[model samples]
Target: MTDQTDEEYREAPSDRTHVKRYHWLARYDQETVKAILDATPLAHVGCMMNGVPFVTPTFFWREGDRVYWHGSSAGRMFHALEHQDICFTVSMLDGLVIARSAYNFNCNFRSVMLLGRAELIKDEDEKAEKLRNFVNGLIPGEWERLRPVYPKEIKATAIASMSIAEASCKVRTGPPIDDDEDYTHPSWAGVIPIRYQVLPPEPDPRNLPDVSMPEDVLKFRLG
Candidate 1:
């Protein structure tokens, strides 16, 4: 945890929330953190088990100030995460910054790091609702058309929720910054932008002949 002066400490302290390196890029605003989380569906969760650090990649969704993820109830990783301290992080690479000098190379990205403990969502009704929201949120109206989650499926899965007790977002955008002398260098330098695009949806071979893609699926776009 980074040390903070008395006045610098937040009312609700998340001791490790501060970004010590490249502090200029750190953003503590709730909206900023939420934006990064909302833009990325994949998250990496880190935790310790048997004195060994483990990081697992999983799909996640955010609602208000809380984040949720689901996994097999029998999985050791989820077992270790439930009711235990964890760090969740999401990052999206936007571009590569090519500079005249190697030392000035950088990446344009948006990222968020959160520190908190996850609580197991054990209530059946609440879990069902959250699962429905997860499906509908990702592709609106799809949940209604799909088969309902069975009680056995719910029993086999574990949903975990972690409040955004302490979080920070870091974003870097625009062009590369090279030394004054590097401006005259022979090498070309600029930002090579990267973006994610939605490709045409492929249907299962066994699908009914009359079925067509839904509007939400056709219009789906990543942030």
Candidate 2:
């Protein structure tokens, strides 16, 4: 992300992340990559285990310039990820574009891909604090009122972290571009906008008579 022009950044930190087609839509700046990852609520984690490839979907969380995700300590994904090369990606599809020609059809989206190895947080106290931050980050005030985490539960979970140092983002927006001759073809051409919204929560039927939705849940926003 340094020693390069905006255009060069698009091509990138390495050939692996370089944008080949539609290179103009790519961005290598730290801000753009971070924002794209933050906007997407989930990150697809990829790694290899026992000579087989695996991609696990997990909640995405960013702290400072790092990315984190958690799973069972004994899980295959976590076991394969520890200090091992891996890739994680996040994407948000914004709309669909209809072009006069079938070949010109495309989807509008923002996406990021990162490469690195995860460092397991071995310190119990630090891991506990990180979990607390992760919970409150997704839902403010929820962690404060929750029951204390048991020692066994902490022992059973694994939290992995890696700096968002090597990554690239590609984003496409606006309407489709069709050949000049195709403009008069009388075919419908426009965008079908997509929206991501948080709907009203449905409380569990088993809640106690006096139980009610918490204020934190009311104001929660995924980012």
Candidate 3:
């Protein structure tokens, strides 16, 4: 965990009633929050343009409790996100938690919804560091292996970052809740675990004969 002073902490008005039964899953430990943030590859950010609203999915990375994403400076999302209120969500499904009753079926998953202000990163050095973080967050040890970004590329792309202060995390685990009457009903109920495994890399026909896949990426594990 990163060290922080008291002044850096902010309490969200929405986090007041965290453990209500209806939103029981919304209460998460710090480790759970970090795990969900680290494992997610993409996030959807919702924002409004004039009277219309939009939800756009894009790649993101987490640094502490902040979420960062980027795109072309002239892109629709990038333009709209600047100086606006945004809500971002990331989710990962682990399995199905089955129960004996029809209403007892539940899902084993982790998700996060963040509310904050989004703005463009204008500093050159900070922009470069954030861009590298976004690329490496998906695959460890990838940023250093890739070639340096061209000057034109930096000028063309825009990076935006939002604080995750006013955020809520929800997770569902274990078996489902069955009705009292359903307890006497005979039915098989259990959980089915899910996982993602990487397939062998496929080479492109136009690639050089000597080119090969990197071991780090080829053997990457989701677990």
Candidate 4:
């Protein structure tokens, strides 16, 4: 239930997860939600600290029904998030919808909003393994090529995870929808498509000149 592994659409676990405005664009299915989450490595986690709300941007990864993010252990955000209710959200814009009217102008996008409580991965070993997975998940085989992570390094970082059981996916696509009479107007109406690209690798100056890009590095692609 957490991972949205089932093919059938499910109901929102709570009213908060349901999409209200533009309700037709809201999706309550596991597959759709999971896809949106996997499409982006970045997300914002909204949490409360000392009664003040804070939204922290983080690089996140998903495994099964859970997602994880990290920050410096000494940072107030991580410590403030422990065992707290959180709103985790990811969004990627695919295109710009140019409409005949300003009101109809919008973005073609896919996004997921997740509701859950945050938990810390307290076990050092598990945390370290998950950290390794994060590096390799973004760049395959990159973790192995780097120096081993120090025990102190692990201690200095905080890993937070949240379940994805209660989540909603919202998406908008295709051309803009304008007033019925706007179709006869001279203004153009269409989508300006956008996409992500993997550029040529830029090696660091400190790297040995003889060192070449690893095969796995070349194999990396944005999901």
- Give every collision pair in model 3: none
TM, every model: 0.91, 0.93, 0.82, 0.92
TM-score of 3: 0.82
Q: Report how far residue 17 has shifted in candidate 1, in Å.
A: 1.5
Over 1-223, each residue of candidate 3 has an lDDT whose tens digit, in order, gives 1232233232223654243454556644456566777785678989987668898888888888677888887888787876677888888888988889767788888887777789789877788888888766666778887888877788788888887666667777777678888878889988999876678767778977886666777756543
Model 4 TM-score (2 dp): 0.92
Give lDDT tens digits, candidate 2, residues 1-223: 1233656755577778787767777788899988987786699999999998889999868998999888889888887787578989999989999999999999999999998888988788888888998899888888887888999888888999988888888888889889989999999999999879998888999988997789889887767
Q: Please identify which of the two predictions, 3 or 4, would achieve the higher lDDT against the true structure.
A: 4
Candidate 2 residue-wise lDDT at 65 = 93
Best-first order by TM-score: 2, 4, 1, 3
lDDT of each: 0.84, 0.85, 0.74, 0.85
Deviation (Å) of 137 in candidate 4: 1.1
C-alpha-based local distance difference test score of model 2:
0.85
Which model is ahead, 2 or 4, in terms of TM-score?
2
Output the worst ten-in-a-row residue range by lDDT, candidate 1.
Answer: 1-10
Q: Return the top candidate by TM-score.
A: 2
C-alpha positional error of residue 140 in candidate 1 after TM-score superposition, expressed in Å: 1.0
RMSD (CA, Å), each prediction: 3.7, 2.9, 5.5, 4.1
Instruction: Extract clashing residue pairs from model 4.
Output: none
* 38-134 per-residue lDDT for model 4 (tens digits): 8879999998888888988999999898999888989888877765778899999999999999988999999999987888898999999999999
* Overall local distance difference test of candidate 1: 0.84
TM-score-best of 1 and 3: 1
